[model samples]
Target: MTIRVVAKNYVKPEKVQDFLGLCKSLVEVSLKDEGCIDYGLYQELENSGVLTFLEEWKDEKSLDQHLNSSHFKEIFPLLSEYLEKETEVNVYRKTL
Candidate 1:
């Protein structure tokens, strides 16, 4: 089954640009990983500092691999410094 992941991040207003730069690196590398179906980053128009990461993977193993990827391990902790609050990450499977 395909896995979908949505991660919502509230970036500190002063760190939005820094956050974006890091996200760019993260997304760029993540897209090349095996089993990555899709990986995209989105920002809220109404709230520029609010960002979201939408990802799709081939299966549970793929998602787990991604979570354990070098980019994820290195970048996610750095991303936390720019966040105003803890990120909200949710995983789902298509039922329809």
Candidate 2:
């Protein structure tokens, strides 16, 4: 089944641009990975500090591989420091 993942980030005001830049790089690398069906970043219209990622992968194994990927590991620390609040990630399997 296709897996969908959503990650919501509440970035510090001072680190917004830096966070976005990092996200851009992350997205670039993610798109190049095997079984990465889709990946994108979005900012809330009313709240610029809130960033969200919408991603789709071929299956659980693909998603697992993505989580273990070098690109993911390399940028995670940088992304973690910018969060004003804890990040939220949710995964779902598409039905129908």
Local accuracy by lDDT, each model: 0.95, 0.92
Tens digits of per-residue lDDT for model 1 on 1-96? 899999999999999999999999999999998899999999999999889999999998998998899999999999999998999999999988
Q: lDDT: which candidate is best? A: 1
TM-score of each: 0.96, 0.94
- Number of backbone collisions per candidate: 0, 0
Task: Flag regions of model 2 displaced more than 4 Å.
Answer: none
